[model samples]
Target: MTPIRHNASGGSDNDTVLDAVRDCVLAVGVRRTTLTDVARRAAVSRMTLYRRWPDVRSLVGDLMTREWIAVATGAIPAREPGTTARDMLTEGLITAVRAFRAHPLFRKILDVDPELLLPYVLDRRGASQEALLELLSGSLREGHADGSVREGHPERQARSVLLIVQSFTLSLRTMTDEDDPDLASEAFLRELRGILERTLTP
Candidate 1:
């Protein structure tokens, strides 16, 4: 993925453009948002936007990449003295699911322009997904070294875990019961935790 364009102080024209794209998507959805609208919001010339992003979809793709990467980075567990890689990876995946579901941009896109995600979901992996898979595979290798995770191809194991996480993050609402007093979604998350544990356990 294109690295987010911001310095230590967090100010850049690219950041401004992506922020405008985010606000436009949140307010009017992706289909309705235009390059002109983003330019206006960013207070930059339309030529400036066109120079960077050819269309709204590409602009939105970059925005989503930035947001999703941030979410995943924040979700990763901090290393400590005795925490096994399996435990860290499991916690990180659960945290990422919760954060993705709660992200305003993610929620807005899923509600108003879910079709925008169909290409990424059905056809090819997005940049964010590739980055996540890299992280997962590295962690799986760590688990193997520590004798915490079962022996397997780390790449395949990471893909399997990503499939499970994607299902929970994207389709979870379909299987949830709003009226259930037991909080079906939370219960299902617990099930997810168990499933990950068993999947990785030696």
Candidate 2:
């Protein structure tokens, strides 16, 4: 059996290892963050980490997911009454994009191994889907009930819009050096807002 660390968190040692993964990812980037390094940072043992995460990629994937969920739920509030659905959505999309783009850890991952981010690209089971689905659900429900978004199907539409937002957000990382990333992002959001406006009434 691998060594395990326990604490008041009461979470599994796997959670501890995952937290350590985040620290190492942020401090040293994914490429250099070894199981040993994570263990050292968490004051756990290598065997403990290995027992939980077999390798850096799996660990990185886990951390990436938690980071997205934390930021979406923690940084943004749910839709409020009298607020246009489009506005809250725009803010949330922009916030998520800016956070991902400005994150040193995420940037490092993009710079080193962009494919790590793609496993969730418009896919059914990954960080992008899970985090966004959770974050958008509340807002969509609110908007639909309040008559902000179109009344046909709240959940389905929310998922579609969120997938688009994530796609645009992810694409920002790949813009040409000569292209202005912010301008491109803004333009994309503008077009997206137009689509949203068409779908929302009253």
Candidate 3:
């Protein structure tokens, strides 16, 4: 669940808590990051922080959600004739994959506490997946109106795309067992992009 964005009493926090969560998670791991530590890092009192989030997990969950929403929103370009819905969707998924690969915090989580990430990915209607599905469904409807997407239920199509994106992007090693994991991961992404393009294109 997302924590309240504002500081105590709705002040101009400007993401101070999220920033603090990221810092604390990086400095220590998720298991060790306490509400006290986050409040100290954010320069707020523990009570003030608790007013927004009950614990560190809740706060970090919000942080991860915000980071992903940023990636998804930034992935799409302004609509134009040349940019079909498929194109926008493909680019957005690629952006997410690349962002995850490059994100220090995400990598840190993977190394320190991959189990923390699994619930969101494994649940069919988890918060993260639902957020992405909502974004994709909106784009699909727009595409249908413009005759760029197939006539179907946008939610179903979006869920399918989300599953594909998550399956391949999250499970990198299954694609290839190259000695250099970095190179293997890149190669896997290239293949994933092609598959998604074919799957989503009308």
Please name the candidate that would achieve the greatest lDDT relative to the true structure: 1
Give per-residue CA lDDT, model 2, range 71-108, as digits (tens).
55554646677667556765666667667777766777
List the lowest-lDDT window of 10 residues for candidate 1. 1-10
Pick by TM-score: 1 or 3, better one = 1
Which candidate order results from sorting by TM-score in descending order? Answer: 1, 3, 2
Whole-model alpha-carbon lDDT for candidate 2: 0.66
Ranking by lDDT: 1, 3, 2
- Native-referenced Cα lDDT, model 3: 0.76
Q: What is each predicted model's overall lDDT from 0 to 1?
A: 0.88, 0.66, 0.76
RMSD list, candidates in order: 3.4, 6.3, 4.0
Error of 2 at 70 (Å): 1.9
Clashes of each: 0, 0, 0
The collision pairs in model 3 are: none
lDDT of each residue in 22-126, candidate 1, tens digit only? 999999999999999999999999998887689999899889888988898788888889999999999989999989998999999999999999998899998
At residue 176, give the lDDT of candidate 1: 86
* TM-score (all chains, Cα) for each model: 0.92, 0.76, 0.86
Please list the residue runs of candidate 3 whose C-alpha ends up more than 4 Å from where it truly belongs after superposition: 1-11, 78-81
At residue 88, what lDDT does model 1 achieve? 93
For this target, which candidate reaches the highest TM-score against the unseen true structure?
1
lDDT per residue for candidate 3 within 72-95, as digits (tens), equals: 666666666677776776776887
